[model samples]
Target: MMTFYNKQTTEQKEFYENLLSSLASLSKLFSSSDTPYLHYRAHEILFCYAFGANNISRGDVSFDATKDGVGIGLKTFLHGNGNTFQKIAEFNSVSDEIRELGSNHNDIAHFIADKRNERLTDTLSITSTKEMLYHVITRNNQSLNIAECRMSFVEKARIKKVTLKKNNIYFKDSLHEYNFSLAKNTLYKKFDISENILHSIDVNIMGNPFQLLENLSVFDTKESTKTMEIILPLYSTSTGDVGRSSGLNQWNASGRERHQDEVYIPIPSWIHNQFPDFFNYKGKTTPSFMVKLPNTDLVPFKVCQSGGKALMSNPNRLLGHWLLRDVLKLQAGQLATRQLLRQKDIDSVLVTKVEGKEYDYELDFLKYGSYEKFEESHKE
Candidate 1:
């Protein structure tokens, strides 16, 4: 029942309208048409700004933003007859399994529904959000429409009918309609705009929007800032598996009987060579620094062990407790395996240096194969 549209104040609505108008004014830059187009990232950021919410799009979770314990998935698309099917999920990694299910519509529906539910459950666990909903924006010739609806899990058990036509599979549950594209390996949910539209605002597209940019003097400044970040794999890259005596299973590391919380995130040597100044490490002492968790708590951390290979919480147990127990829902002695990580669709942690008066960093979850993409982007 957590609705973003119903909870917006007049001031917030005004701000949102103004933001959309400003965005619409730049439509001519992309297209000659008067119809306004809103970029998805801009929608996510501006929505968070207007509503005083935290933007979690970079986390790559099911939801893009969170407010009042509610996780919201923001969507923007062209308006069509107050009813449209927008993509909600992609299953490229599991497309083979879906194809193997063949013409068995019931089995395909169940598989897709289960995968969707798993993603939602994992997102909720990581973000600690109580509810999930979709806050959508639909663009027309001269206006933008806003709508909100519950992001419900597909009722797999109650799927009454399913149809397969060409490369698309269509199904209906008690709550909603769904479509799976075999060619694209994607899932889309139908949104009824007429029933859900809470607000509509007219966008007056400026004829000479370039003049507005020309008048701005701030663009002349040369100073720029970029976030320093890196992604570390959860499993050992050399062995291609979660080592029984290392990584998340560090408690099983030989030599000394370990506490249940004895675990550390492995930092590759290349990171130390490339960004030597990123971590404050000198000689033998482990220099402690603060790390902001996704839940907004600042916890002490340090680079320890020979060659600064391990990044761990101050007591070495705090990070493990959160990553292994809380997020992954693993028991005290449960071994964290690479298969388990892949099953959850997360295999790495994104560490971003927090720019402030104090030396600190922030951590977020990244889906599997993200580290390779990050590496490719940084390749010299």
Candidate 2:
């Protein structure tokens, strides 16, 4: 087993130990029994805080936090002898496809394996993380165990056998065992504790957490403000796919032969109609602003084309190079199809308005149906 403490300083180890104990003690307020439970979200936040990592949980990608170019997927579950199968992915959106495959174990196994691999690829591309690992926290009533293992893609070629029982399908690659549930449309992977455990911590549950809270005289109740954001779909809404002659395939748009990197994000007319003041523009002049990319580089952006229907980076190719070449890994002159977007589990980019600026925004990728969810949340 790897020693996580060996890589940490004495001070860091002390802080981590204290943090876990405090969390355990505080968890008593919500539990009916004396046993303290660590919530998964709390584990993610505190893990990042203790390790000086950037919390990327909001992105809803495979990983929850990143540090030193490593993307970490945080998992916390009840520890039962340090070995258990925990959920790793969900395919509820494609549940119909899995159901249609029925009892074809090989086909179902291959299909889900491909989907899992696609998400891993998408996570790495979007986060620009050099490596990925699962940082799991397994907890019993009195203690928590930390384990680390490589976050691997399901080896499609190495899928040796697939078995089906009831609504669950089981399969294994050379490195890991996987289970897929048709009932829940979720994927689970076996985490072998004996092979990966790095640290073990004992937490003391407070007998009376209510008394501790009652001793505090003041509490902060103010809620943090939500960022104003908009979702712009990668595919054209009119066609439900990348337009052959426009959108991401704009290189094929007629006139003169265009550069392969001449793509632009399409902005629907309804977006401007609903949020008229979102983009800055005068009567005749085009609107120009700055967009901060995931890599922290700010590039000049402009709304162009008739009725301001396109959002393109100034010098135009910059945005395309990042979106098409870097993130999507599209080849030159290759069209960005809807299938390709779905494979990446991302169909849109969320543009959040930067504070203190009317036009400047930050861009992050979003999963499919995010735009629909965003709109539903804003319904009158």
Candidate 3:
């Protein structure tokens, strides 16, 4: 697991200091209530106010607070400890919305640990933890490590896919009804949609959602540049569809062993429509194009612009592929375009084709030894 330093730079210190102050005031106002659920709302409300994210009727989803919305809805987890959480029925909304929202089994949740310090002004840690577990099972007098035996099975269990039935009373409180503070404070004032932190979030925002970061790093500092992974699909206003470009030829490359640490980002035809100059090559050769991405200071990606499509398969592992399919979070033939953007942010892009299934690093590893291999396999 990668760890980020707790120390803040001058700019980070200034921004967080005011953010903590705003949180302090909000905490005080909500602290007056004796209700346990209200305390939870304080966290949800803080997320909304501080970052312009808003919750639905019963805390099912949080949308981007920006004007240009990203269609994805962030999964929210709030409490002193996030080791466990409950999902109750949302009676106010239609059953279908609740079922659809509930069935999405993605582990990408915006987590806020309300770890109370002596003072409310203390800086809070907004972190995400991937749910990983290992266990040993015995069958037919033989011992088996379940994780080593079937890694996919272990991964599937962490996801929640079943519909909520009669006794499904996971969440009983209503965090949505209590409207606390939407106005800005120091922390809220400093919040910007362009920040890289928003890219990983699955929530929806109010306004025009900020353009998704082209790449994501696990660490906030530059020393740990190549470790970031794009866990969420980003929305782009200018390029139209900018993400793990589906329908492009599977990236097939040599030297899989040497390129184990590399990352891959596909560029679809829509990108060509926007930047025709970059991919105007008419030959069969895979050409290279250099261009700057939004909200990141990393070096320009090593792009292979071919057949009106481009992909970033950096040999040094700079841009990792989005592992949506590897985890089975998305199916190949489903109407997955809806899953790409937050529900509210869907209007930002004209939906031309649904994002059908595509290959991931793990699949590439099985077919070829390299995690970055992009060899086009026969489309099933």
Predicted structure with the largest TM-score when compared to the true one: 1
Off by over 4 Å in 3: 1-15, 19-266, 275-300, 316-380
Clashes of 2: 0
Residues 251-325, candidate 1, lDDT per residue (tens digit)?
988897788988888887777777777785664547788987766557899998888888999888988888887
Q: Give me the candidate number with maximum lDDT.
A: 1
Each prediction's TM-score against the native? 0.92, 0.82, 0.26
State how far residue 242 of model 3 sits from its true place (Å): 15
Question: Residues 1-380, candidate 3, lDDT per residue (tens digit)?
Answer: 11111222446434433443333333223333221111334443443444433222121112111111221122222322212232211122123333454433231110000111101111000001122111111111111111111001112223233222332211111111111111110001011112112112111121211222223335455332221111112222234443333321122234333332233444444444443444343444344433221111123334354553334534423333232232113443332332343322211211111122121111111111111121122111
Write one digit per residue (lDDT tens) for candidate 2, span 54-125: 666766478887766777888888778777899999887787788898789899999999989888887787
Clashing pairs in 2: none
Q: Candidate 3: deviation at residue 72, Å?
A: 18
TM-score for candidate 3, please give it: 0.26
Against the reference, the lDDT scores of all candidates come to 0.83, 0.80, 0.24
lDDT of 1 at 239: 87
Candidate rank order under lDDT? 1, 2, 3
